[model samples]
Target: MHLPIELDRDRAEPLQNQLYEQLRGLIIARRLKSNSRLVATRFLAEKLGISRTTVLLAYERLISEGYLETRPAVGTFVCAVLPDLVPAPQINDNRVDDLPQTELRPPLFQSRMPVGEPVEPALIDFWGGPDFRIFPLKIWQRITQHVLECYGKGISRPPPSAGIDPLRGAIADWLAAQRGIIVDRDQIIIVAGAQQAYNIAARLFLQRGDRVVIETPGHAGASFLFESLGATQHPVPVDEHGLLVDALPDGSTSLAYVTPSHQNPIGGTLPLERREALIEWARGAGAYLIEDDCDGDFRYRGMGPPSLKSLDPYGLVLYTGTFSKTLGAGLRLGYMVVPQELVASTVAVKTLLDNGSPWLEQMVLAEFIASGEYDRHLRRVRKTYLERRDCLIAALRLHFGDVQLAGVDTGTHLTWLLPASLPSAPAVQEAARQRGIGVYTVSESEIGGRPATLYTENALLLGYSSLEERQIRDGIAGLAAALRDHRRAATG
Candidate 1:
């Protein structure tokens, strides 16, 4: 049978890749049905004007990736267990004809913001937001088992709407001792993660058309949530120190979201003076500050500054902390220390949002923190991550010579400013990907929205926490080679 297979031999992509992509598209589009037989390699080669070896290699790759099946004695075919295709539903012509056509109303929110597609399994994911390789999984497993063994009977049922009391108490005590926020255990409301905590805060405070302040290049999740809730978001610019507090509007704002500890995307730590200024701004405007401390536990270079919530005398800050960075994103455990005045309202909102987080995980995490194991684990991983960060910086300098590194004083990743002679950030990212190395640029949504040319055009983000020291060096060398090649081609 003739199939719609085409190859571009002149393209940069390999012949095998072209063939694999065409066949995969056919299968996904359902042009090639499940269990349908594919033409023999020789037949396909002749039909497509490609060599038989190329066809054979492509077929082998497809089979290995689970898109095709090969029978020893018979032939190759589309996988029998492939998902069934659903045809598009038909629209009613008569109903459409009878309806009066009018101008459609503009949507209250902008069209959905495009998210970065998941990294292909074959590629190294240097863009993964948080490090998972160094997670204390063994220790966590032991703690989880201990919790189940000791508290199994109590957790068999659903936890209270406010979450397990002991876990809340542990979180409260931890915050008071570490974050300097004095709050009753009753004010601590546990949620799955900061995402859920944000949702709860939105529900409690935001109304349609309410104005909210967000960093210009802020967390996409927070931006999307505010947009989804019909709130108008005003983008506030961020500088080397952190958010520009002076840029905030003077009037009332329903909510202000800031990543004070380690700002997302840029990794700037908000200075103590800036933190105080932010608090004053929030108080004067009578707005709530949603402090997203997603990476508060991984401060490396210097003594970390105290949390903004700790200095908040007016109970204006809704302090949110997550274990996603310190522990793992999969754990999905985080807590918010609500001010005494907002406790009842926050709990009511939490109750409405999925009742509460799972009891078992919360219990186990609480026990982990209580036993002091969490602190020890942080100390161990922090050292390793700090070393990796330094290795990445040193390798970049050795290869590229005097590269400007930003956000290196803290956090799991740092941004390198490419020289004008090199290719742009996106160009560098794509070139590295071709060599099986993952390097991110500021323009990519993975780092947030298209960063201004000043911030993104000449910058690349290298996340070294998850990669080994050797891998880090190799990846940098690969990137340097790719950049050199690009420059040569451009001049030629």
Candidate 2:
């Protein structure tokens, strides 16, 4: 049988490394069962349209990594004993040791949730979004009050479609310093939020019957938006490292929407290798890539990878970012950095779509960034979220041994693969719900297209940004108890 493997000749990553990663992912995910026979290198190479030497090198790497074993004169097969699924947490080369997972008192800003109170939810829901409790209410209020005192007149008049000059310039400066992107303010179009930013992008690049590439189990909102625009979507599967660039459609693709920096639902950060490959593919195919960096600012892994837009020299990337992940989603503020050619078109589209975002908020945000309070706020929240994430992971390990997780060491949320002893992800979700706790299956969350079976069948998405350490720990314990009750009921 032909293995489900594809290679991209245009990618900068070596074919051998590409093949090895795919095979390794499959093996780790258990798609290739223990002792499952692999086809001969010659046959596999021929099937994949690559040289036999490439296949041999990939196989050798897998063997050395303990994923496969070759029986002399017989055939190679998946190893009966695979490598440890729960390897030690990765420490970036720049860091000496992992951050302590201990829970510290939250910053003073996080002392109050929305409505100016610390009321806890009855269900203990871990709904994904910004933690409103951590919002810099005092600073934001001071800025808002100041902006109103100064620019209150502009609020009554219609704001510029592309955004106010101060905010745009401030955003440009912020991107240059934080994300290594040096685009002019004129190329930046502020919108209601990521939703509107995506809508603007979909309108510009997509037409009826146009082909759009989307990550499977990606942000459902993006898929729905493209579909509503009458663009036919092509689903590309994502592994732990984010979108499988090799699996991207070859040609006739008008646009490809990606969440390279902390993908929604799955939580994997796209590595530099695949980021380069994606850029190459977009350039060669003459298509546009939308890089959604919504959660890019909340990386726990020592100043994570650079934005994909930073690596794109071809003007093919449309970088979208939002404050919803940091500030409250209720604020509804987001921006998109477009190529020079599309700036006018995007501005026109923004003009037509609500004529721009709120003026007062934009003014306040501009001052917030210019004064460097935004950076300080991010540092505070990042530390808090990191502590919560670690607490959640530790809770899972405490309740369920050897917890297999994805998209860890970064992002506000992570994906957990339920052990075989537990029920399906949906079933687990139901059990958790019955116990007045919130957990989500891949499908129940904002998944874009159909996810791989490994994710859909067993993985549950958990968001830790909104939860405190105590809440995270309690939620996991409650979930574990719910699963136990569910299993007992099923057996009976």
Top-TM-score candidate index: 1
Predicted candidate 2 versus true structure: per-residue lDDT over 183-271, tens digit per residue: 99999899998888888888888888999988877777777778777788888888888999989887768899999888776888888
lDDT of 1 by residue, 51-140 (tens): 999999989988877889999889999996664443434557867554554334444556345355354721454663555666778988
TM-scores, each model vs. reference? 0.76, 0.74
Error of 2 at 462 (Å): 1.2
Give the worst 10-residue stretch by lDDT in candidate 1: 444-453
91 Cα displacement, candidate 2 (Å): 74
Pairs that collide in candidate 1 are none
Candidate with the greatest lDDT versus the true structure: 2
The superposed Cα distance between candidate 2 and the true structure at residue 379, in angstroms, equals 0.9
Candidate 1: residue 242 Cα off by (Å)? 1.0
Q: What is the C-alpha lDDT of each candidate?
A: 0.81, 0.84
